[model samples]
Target: MKSGEWDRGRFVGVELQGKTLGVIGFGKIGRHVAHMGSGLGLEILAFDPFLAPHMAEELGVELVADLGDLASRCDYLTVHVPKTEGTSALIGADVLSRAREGLRVINCARGGIVDEAALLEAIESGRVAGAALDVFEEEPPTNRELVDHPAVVVTPHLGASTREAQVNVAVSAAQLVVDYLQHGKLHSPVNAVFLEPDLRERLDPYGELGRRLGCLHAQFLEGNPKRIIVKYFGDIFDEPQSRNFVTAKVLAGFLGDRCSQPVNQVNARSLARDQGLAVEEASEGRSRYFANMIRVELTDSSGERNLGGSIRGRKGIRLVSLDNYHFDAVLEGQMVISANEDRPGMIGTIGQVLSSHEMNISSMSLGRDRSGGTALSVINLDAPEIEKLAAVAEDLMQEEGILWARCLQAD
Candidate 1:
């Protein structure tokens, strides 16, 4: 059964217990469904090429690298991949064409991934005995003929709708794609610290630090952060944008992910200065590490907080502030990794893995998804284990298979 399907409290085949739940797009709700389904004692198998193999192993799930492989192996194949340009109509006739007998299919992701017409044919032929869908390729797929079928169970998209579910999903995870988007999603990063080398070089040492920390704090903002104000201090004003221009540029560029176009150092500052913040301020760094610091005053949908930080070293960017929460971290390959459903021994699992590699965590941010889901955590570590970190991130993303995307925290 799909995650939304489970909480919806609609259909429960007592016979459904102990059945395998094959999922595509290991994301938020997908993971929720898998976790919740454990009461059924069902084996969880999934297919998601974008996910790393190690992450899957920890979930104790069987990972199928390819879609066809998942279909061939699963007792019930449920899809949760997104509805991107490439994913539209992904599992058309070709995918449905191959199947073992009595294969059940569920589509709680986007509607387009499965070929509706072909699915009906499979249902009629007994290749697929039952099917469930929450979304359609077309919002409210007008094709009553397909939706009205007896073998197919349908619902409007309701993945993270419950009050309890809402709070669980919106927690401290960097990307709440599943709780926010509801369905299969990629555990992708927001590219918070990406900029051209020349452009990055142009930013002052302190400004670079501000950019990284500012970007990191900005990543987990629950609601929209409409307005931002950046300010510089001390003798760092030797550059051309030392005035209002430099401040605006970083804020604008940082805000780029929410928008499509590039935000530059030129008008970026001015645009932010005029945002919704009733008041915003920037400050100087007083630490022994640097002469000054950058401070941003902003307002989000929820509440407001003052953000400050400074950078050190010749090339690498480090996190120097988290709203007065004292911590120092470099902005290179270093990562802020987190996981929830933090059961009694959840931390032990990730710790065991990190310990095996001798990786050291510089800092950590701990949180919980909800009452029952699990705990969420963020880890700041040295950049020594590059491939190892990437492997862990990939594994987490792949293992969930569109359920929860392992958001790689950065600054």
Candidate 2:
């Protein structure tokens, strides 16, 4: 009409009301489009293999098992799924051939999901009426035939090009990077780690404790970590979804010393993958000791070591178990852990060594199954300004009963 080329009957447009609108991926954006389309009286149908049937029902959208079923029933087909190996050319010649006659297609998603060549053929053959594409297989698309096609409507991929949307995307990307860099957080990670919204809030504290355990384990172990196993026990494992966040946190802590770059939940698993290290996770109904436990085992060339912790009722995070010994101590501030034989005067000897170095002991915890057997001592220090605490740890290791000692700082 703008060019005075209007052919009243030839350029007829159809109303959207009562027409079926098929959405391929019902994630964040797809659901939004479905809601808006439904408001305009268009019947909504969708296909997402991972989507629960009840969720689709709640959205007033009928869920279809496959793309073929969606194509045969809808007047308009829209692609919103991510471009992956399985989704490249997801709607190809076969899908377009089986689609409802004169079907109009829309792709506001990533490029290459719909085969442009097939779309062109469908349009020319009158199997497809027209298409509205905001994206293309190539930017500044070189194919003039499709770009100039009278039946197709094209735009310079402007799905989120509006000023507000661009600003929002920029801010979100920057924030995710900053959060991961400074505080080891990824609000929405783009990896295998998935933490449900409801579970994240409930499991955050445990995640922190799990990371601390990983950090401690890495510091205590002598050689490079070749494999790690994170085990969840008791009520926490019952939730199932809690493990992902816990595993990511454990990895973040374990890799903290291994990487020069910032280690956080987002890149932790990826970093581990790059190093060719093996990570395994398991959950059991109960722990042999604590009701709820997060245990992390590290295996290096020398041998394997276990470090476990649990959250006590309202008292916050505790160092529940270290190797075979068990005790409850706050997991914070400067502390020293020692593996030693249980014997008289061992505690006094450790305190004497700290006093000799002018270091103050704030609190102390000792755990052992039997007297004169193996034992672990965790001594919280009040001397926060001591930079060379390792020298003092070396001094403690020289004592008669003490086997090994290491200094640690936790928060």
Candidate 3:
């Protein structure tokens, strides 16, 4: 004990082998950290308001309902959440003050998620044993005293600076470009909003449905459009990410049909704006027909029209409603659609035309309000020639019973 710097007789340290680790956010990075801690024989507990219960169980973590419960039980705590209004100063004086003594905290997520002043108070008052801060409220922090504190360890924000991480990021960026250029696949998007993996999976079908819906409307219009409004119903309204995906696809379909140049999800919005077309969105959770649905309404000099679609369990993407007529038909392949009077021989007349042209009917569905009112007939065909389908539609429109007819080919 010559220098007297080391307390040789009273040495103490917290072992992580059997201790509890509390994770604030169960995002990608948080899950990785939890896996590492689990491998080290540490019990992992997590609190994420958005994370589902099954996800935590799958990660072998106990999901805590409250922050205070997690703070009081953990020997060590770490935060991994984005910097948002809801998460600003998430772990503050109150959380630290209520924490059990000898608790060590780590903040490597964002600067403002943890209050530095409250952390210093906890350290000084012995409420916290130590803190490892990789980020500060201010970069090159003005408060040097806190950084120099004996119980605190600081890093220069090099969290994602590893060589492997750099390579991954560069590859991801290049892949995003290649995906867009080569396949029109938007894997990694900049303008597209972020969504949880589960939510994305659930909403994938709707994106396709939205594109087809828009295409159907555009084909039906065959003229200049004044305005387009997209409506979301049921749980789809809760997810903001779905808005971008659906709207982008809708624009892609509509513009791709009308524009001479190729239109995709990335460039659809700009194209819509350049064409002096008004784009709007609305959402309502209430739906009398289905749990979730997307409707696209188009207004032009001619009139107003609406097309609606939804994802049904095993049925896949279905065109649920077109204007006042409601029908369930898969929006795929070559389709000949006709709006006509609810005549008894309407289906026979359409079938006779296809039979005479040697075009096989893949599937056909008819929808109408009543036996004597207006009706809609969607006939999927093996017919590929646009002229042949157009001839059939033209023939139907010329008939006394048919009001309007259109040929839509899906590419």
Candidate 4:
């Protein structure tokens, strides 16, 4: 109307009906998108490693096993995944290269999930048709080329900008405060453990240890958790309350930010159960070495990972054993854990990498199954940023003997 030109043919766009919509990360937002896309007569395919098959079936969405397969089959691909170590740059050149030609991309989720640079190249090469991005790797993105592309549409990351969303946020926050004040119910508690004053004095240290161990396991956890087996060793856990409280604490740590709901000691077990995870606890009268010890074993599709923690007399909390390797490592601050072959200069190589990055090592603990076998090194770094820690871990894994390196923010 403004240009005094009305050409229906020129404004014609592809019809979404009967087109396949592939949704990566089947969380709340992803599920909603799938439902809406289905209503619009679009076939839905989802790929989320953590989402159960039964759940997807109930929603009438076909769950694709692989990301590449989803990309190859879908006409439109939308991402709603969280930005994590595994998901960073998830839809990069490799995924785009394998996509169905003329695939239209949409990302209203977190930034850095789709490599913007790679997406731009794919568009230029005529592999990708277009893109609609609500988020970017950098807020107020500096990449003008991608933002100004003719086939691309960019938004200022306004996913929650609706009036209804604003109202919902305000209402939810007020309701949470009201519920907490009236009924002593905490939907989302900041602190890990919540206990009575008397119990706090006796069980605080043990609870902290359990939470730390769970957190450590979660950082490096592979696949969705199936079963969590927590073993209590020593006389300290003889009381029923002590064991129960600590078990909940362990779940609190393991499920921390992984769950959609707020996790506290009160609701951790229930939340774990809701996710189709089995919780088990065992008690032993005596520990092999320490006076008291708590071991958490998480079994997933990949394999089982076990971590043991104990509260030293003066050390507060210490990670005593990881899997079959036993050594004492302080369970606090930022840490870099690596599995490497037992060899000369391995420690020096790790140190040199950190030193090159100007990262200071606060403490180091080394454990091995045998003299000439694989070893685990837990090195504490003095307050390195998460980005730097991840880079350092990646650098460490590039070394000759290092098998894998994981960065842990224990704080």
> In model 1, where is the ten-residue run with the lowest total lDDT?
270-279
Summarize candidate 3's per-residue lDDT along 30-108 as a digit string, tens digits: 8889999999999999986444455556667888877888899999999987775457889999889889788999999
Q: State TM-scores per candidate.
A: 0.41, 0.52, 0.52, 0.77
- The TM-score that candidate 4 achieves is 0.77
By lDDT, the candidates rank as: 4, 2, 3, 1
List the candidate 3 regions with Cα displacement exceeding 4 Å. Answer: 1-191, 260-266
Residue 255, model 4: Cα distance from true site in angstroms: 3.8
Tens-digit lDDT track of model 4 for 154-204: 999999999999999999999999998999988766564545687667678
Summarize candidate 2's per-residue lDDT along 310-331 as a digit string, tens digits. 8877438788887778888778
What's the distance in Å from true for residue 155, model 3?
63
lDDT of 1 by residue, 99-158 (tens): 767788888776777888888888898887778888787887788766899888888887
TM-score for predicted model 3 compared with the true structure = 0.52
The runs of at least 3 residues in candidate 2 whose Cα sits more than 4 Å from the true structure, single-residue gaps closed, are 1-198
lDDT of each: 0.59, 0.81, 0.80, 0.85
Relative to the unseen true structure, what is the Cα RMSD of model 2?
19.8
Candidate 1: Cα lDDT at 255: 53
**Cα lDDT for residue 294, model 4?**
90
Q: Which one wins by TM-score: 1 or 3? A: 3
lDDT of 1 at 303: 63
